[model samples]
Target: MKLNVLYFAWVRERIGVASETVETDAGSINELLDELSAREERYAIAFSDRSVLRCAIDQTLVPFETSLANATEVAFFPPMTGG
Candidate 1:
């Protein structure tokens, strides 16, 4: 499936792009991350610390184990602070 993946804040900085369309066969968000992490050194660096990452599928926040079935968008970012 093709997914429109979004990166926010430092994720964008490290990956050198804010967003991109990715063709993936990942069944879940965690698997997707693993796929991207293997793409290049920059991707590995951007997603190095999974603990600091938060994800949302199609705008609604979801856990990494969430399935990607029928999902067209996925976003990754750091946890938000109280501000």
Candidate 2:
């Protein structure tokens, strides 16, 4: 399946891209993360801390274990704080 992966905040800085299209066979967000983290050193660094990350599939917030069935997009970012 093809997924449009989106990065924000520090994640974008770490990975050096805001977004990219990736071909993956992952069944869930966690699985997709594993695939990405293994791709290169940058990816590994970007996803190194799962506890500080939040995921949203198709614009809806979901858990890491959430299934990726029929999903076209996946977004990863850190929690927000008041400015």
Off by over 4 Å in 1: none
The candidate scoring highest on lDDT is 1
Estimate candidate 1's alpha-carbon lDDT, on a 0 to 1 scale. 0.98
Steric collisions counted per model: 0, 0
Error of 2 at 41 (Å): 0.5
TM-score of each: 0.98, 0.96
Highest TM-score against the true fold, candidate: 1
Give model 2's TM-score versus the native structure: 0.96
Error of 1 at 27 (Å): 0.2
lDDT of 1 by residue, 1-83 (tens): 99999999999999999999999999999999999999999999999999999999999999999999999999999999996
Q: How does model 2 fare in lDDT? A: 0.96
